[model samples]
Target: MRLYVTPASPWVRRVRVCIDELGIGDRFEYVQTRWPHAWGTRTVEMPADFVEATPVVRIPALVADDVTLTDSHSIIDYLDGKFGNHRLLAADGPGRWKAQETNALACAILEAQIMRRAELLRIGADRSDDFIAKMRDRGLRCFAALEKQVPSFGDAFDLAQITTAVACGYDDWRYGPAWREAAPTLTGWYDTVAQRPTMKATEPAETPER
Candidate 1:
């Protein structure tokens, strides 16, 4: 299997973390997608190799023996089905639904942050006070809701934690570490999550040129 990813991407990081946690890193090759040092731009030409390969040009696309899957959630769902004993997504019932729901919310938080950051760079403004306050408030609200719900997911890493960690990690990387001050419980949760080998290995750092 080949996993195409961009190091700074939370979506791609989620997949890498999943593969690492499953102790199956050797089963897949990780290739860097998106040009190095290129920011806020994407070129969407299907490679001659993958012209019939897949319809998507996004990162975290997984190429299995005969199948190509895009979207991190779908890719993880496939992995969980094959290698997970109902670990990432619950094996049955409402638990699966809830996990999916939480994952969606978490993704939204990350998406909003990404868009906000893009806007910041585009306009040559760090971040507008009103813009940031709105985003921070939204993130905190999501964080609070997750904090109350995460305890029920039990000890081992779950989808909720993966999404939460990636979102918070992104904030730390692109925004400021002071978010730890605004969301302490979430920050503490991240600290514990970061101790996992997968999280440690995949944690995003500013690209060398940045």
Candidate 2:
């Protein structure tokens, strides 16, 4: 199996953390991909087969045997089912729905963070302050929502927690500590989760020049 990734992407990091937590990191090869800039102005040169595997050109693309999974959600689902015995995610029942709900909020926060970064990358004249502000506000709103849901987050470090931690980590790295104000309880939860070896190992970093 080959996992295409960029260190700076929280989406990619989510999958990496899951793989590590499942003790399946050794089963796959990690292929580094890059964006031209931190805000993903464009992709750096990529291998032809990688392009074939992920025509959409997204990170967290996984190629295993005859199957190619694009996008972080699909990759994680595949890993949880195939390699993780549904440990990262529940197979059915109320637990699956609860995990899905929490994951949705976390994924939304990630989307808002990335969109906010893209807006910030624009030139002063081209940037829309209103749009940037909208993304920031949306992310904070989700943070608050997650804070309320944290108590329900049981003992297992499942997919929801992994994704939520990734979102928190990215918000810290890209947008600083402002989100903590909206999610004080979540802030405490994340501080503890961030210490995990998987989280520490996959900390976000600058995309290197190819």
Best candidate (score: TM-score): 2
Index of the highest-lDDT prediction? 2
lDDT on C-alpha atoms for all candidate structures: 0.73, 0.91
lDDT of 2 by residue, 1-210 (tens): 999988988899999999999999999999897566533454456779779989887788999997899999888888899888899998899999999999999999999988888778777597899999999999999999999999998999999999999999999998899999999999999999999999999999977655
Candidate 1 per-residue C-alpha lDDT over 57-176 given as tens digits, one digit per residue, 9 for 90 to 100: 556788899678988878998898898876877878997888777777788778778666644554445447677567777776776666666556557688777887898888788877
TM-scores of all candidate predictions against the true structure: 0.82, 0.95
- Candidate 2: minimum summed lDDT over ten consecutive residues — where? 35-44
lDDT of 1: 0.73
Where is model 2 more than 4 Å wrong at Cα? Answer: 38-45
